[model samples]
Target: MRLVATPFQRRPAPAFAIAVFLAITAFANPASAATPTQTQPRASVMTVAAHSQIDTRISGLHTRLQITAAQEELWQKVAQVMRDNAGTMDSLRQARTSQANNMSAVDDLKSYGQIADAHADGIRKLTPAFQALYDSMSDVQKKNADLIFQTDHHHAAKKG
Candidate 1:
């Protein structure tokens, strides 16, 4: 008997791969992982704290990219998507924290799936806006943007 992979099996493998990649990318950056801690009573409070950090990061990127007035609209779109993704993750985290004690293993996995889906959705929305901004960038700005978006492991290895 020959073993064969079904279409469903093949389909889920790529989706699972993407979910793993997004999970790693989302959690790898300390700044990006600004979801409310156990001590934080409200995600809103954590969001307020995170806003400044996000602004600082975005501002640095803006300067590095040397964004012009023409590119500001697309930049704002990308920035807004980043903010939305953070808020969605924070909300998901808060919901999971509140319900964790009552949730079954399957339920907990479902909650994680929701968070992962949100991360994927955020990337979907961000890509077009980011592509627009990237297309408008000068050669130097494009290089800076590439560096800014590169994985931490790659960046660190290069630096070291």
Candidate 2:
């Protein structure tokens, strides 16, 4: 018997999903205050918040995956990518903040493109390490890993 692995049939590996989620979070929440004139130390505050969120997500995924000692090296590589991606995004965000008032429309679009490119690059770097870890996983571990990446509604439906 022969089997084929199709894109639709393949679940996102946990590390990749976490990286993607972090990238999405970075873009979705712009460093803007609720009020235009409201003054707060937004840059530092947002940077800390972003790091905290990334740390929490990584911890949750690590626990859910139950990563074995054998997989630790692969996990470390994936974790580093997540941290690097977060730092890059945070730097880009801070740059945007400093130039928010002075940026032209073309410059703004270029900045957005830079952020998008960084996310894509991060995912590209994350995939191989995550695939190695996924390959090391047993059947039960693979199922658990897959579940970690499922949407809330899908997970709930599966549970019910």
Candidate 3:
């Protein structure tokens, strides 16, 4: 059976990159069924799409957060963490996709575990940097940040 409909459901993309940051954990099995030529192109296309999404999300978050000039240094740190997290996610994805055809059920579960761990690790790295930036925000900016982040999780946390 196929487990589809991940990253987001009917929900729109978040104004911030929270969706992208949290979206890295799930992947589908379509690559396992693809021919060599198809797989290569698909992987290449996916790489481009993933990077594009990452860049867009970062820019959106920067704009929506309205980071001040004083916060620029802290913001750069947070942005770097986001980029690092994306790189880590992409690396794990490439590993899993390469091994997809030969994976056993146990291997599949292990791969999922790996992805989850990477997500956790990303949050671990991201939290402090983001927290520093968040700590520096003005009260209005904080409120905006709170609202933007709070909504992004509603769809991600859904059971279905």
Candidate with best lDDT: 3
* lDDT by candidate, in order shown: 0.52, 0.57, 0.62
Best by TM-score: 3
Which tens-of-lDDT digit does each residue in 88-122 have in candidate 1? 45555455555556665555455555555666766
Model 2 lDDT per residue over 1-160, tens place: 4354232221221223234433421221122322222321222344676678677767777888999888888888777767767666665556566666666555555555555565676678777878888999999999988777676435433432
Query: Which ten residues in a row are the worst by lDDT in model 1?
Result: 20-29
C-alpha lDDT (0 to 100) for residue 56 of candidate 1: 61
Looking at model 2, which ten-residue stretch has the lowest summed lDDT? 6-15
Per-residue lDDT of candidate 3, residues 21-129 (tens digit): 5544633223344443432222233466567777787788899999989999998888777766665566556666666777766656655655566667677878898
TM-score of 2: 0.66
Model 2 regions more than 4 Å off: 1-47, 152-160
Better of 1 and 2 by lDDT: 2
TM-score on alpha carbons, each prediction = 0.63, 0.66, 0.73
lDDT of 1 at 20: 15
| Better lDDT candidate (2, 3) | 3
